[model samples]
Target: MKRRPRRSVPALLSALVLLAACVLVAVSAIQRILGERAWIDYDTVAATLHNLHWTDLATAVAGSLLALAGVVLLLAAIVPGTATVLPLAGRFDSGVARGGYRTALRTAAAGVDGVSTARVRLGRRRIKVRIDTTRTRPDGLAETVRTAVADRLDRIGPATSPAVKVRVRAPRRTT
Candidate 1:
């Protein structure tokens, strides 16, 4: 089973805030029940709520913001980010980093004649490569890049070979 990435910052902040609130409420309740001096004054809280009439707009905005935050947190916990590692086809459980695959593909594609630079984007089901070349006639450039990238992918022995798409573009001339 794939594990979800933890949103540590938001989760930690929310936990700390909830813990602090719970502690404060528990402490005040215990003190009040034991006939000791309570930290929170119920009369003052009641009066403040009773007299709070003009601040409804502010309260509504705050409530909406809180609801939006809750929705974001929920989505973050439920949604998983793109897989960073691709599983290899072998007896032993092993994988390659997506960055490593992309760098290798870029180097392989750039090695083609007339190709100045290469940018590769590797996805779960496809590999997109954009090649820039100074040559006016980039004939068969896409085919060359496609074959080279496909061969490299084959040698990597990933569980599934992603489809390769190559786009060749002329390098922009500088003044």
Candidate 2:
């Protein structure tokens, strides 16, 4: 299936700012070495661009390329597998969907007898279900909850089995 890219405006802006800053810093250092006559300053260079006194244009071009490279690297580091900035429509709802699935599993597990509490976690690759039973002899409690979870999820999709885990703690003793 073709999945769309997820876009983040703030992240893109931050990358652009970082790129500009890097380019400015590189240009300044190069100018300082080449003396004040160098047209590295943004305003001076823009007004007297026709001067072309030295090969500073080459330095500027190199700096711009370096800045572009930095932006590409930043995007790659932040966006996982994507090397370039990909435009996306809106944020993804995977978190919400996973939460809903987890909630369903918890509710179903809690419905079982002697189930004290159920903590369900659905991960990107798998689903983990933890159930604390009220009795020492949990017996078929784990199997029951596992079956319940599988059945509930069957309507939507199939899950990797043995993923549902039920932990039975010792029964609480009366004071």
Best by TM-score: 1
| Native-to-model Cα distance after best TM-score fit, residue 125 in candidate 2, in Å | 4.5
Off by over 4 Å in 1: 1-6, 12-50, 53-55, 171-175
On a 0 to 1 TM-score scale, where does candidate 1 land against the true structure? 0.71
**Per-residue lDDT of 14-74 in model 2, one digit per residue for the tens?**
6799899798878887887777644456667667767654569776887889799778767
Worst 10 residues of 1 by lDDT: 1-10
> Which digits, one per residue and each the tens of the lDDT, describe model 1 over residues 1-175?
2223458878998999999989998998899889998899767878977876655987778888999989998987778777777788888888877778789889989998889999998776989999999987777889998999888888888888889999999855454
True lDDT of residue 138, candidate 1? 78
Residue 70 of model 1, lDDT score = 93
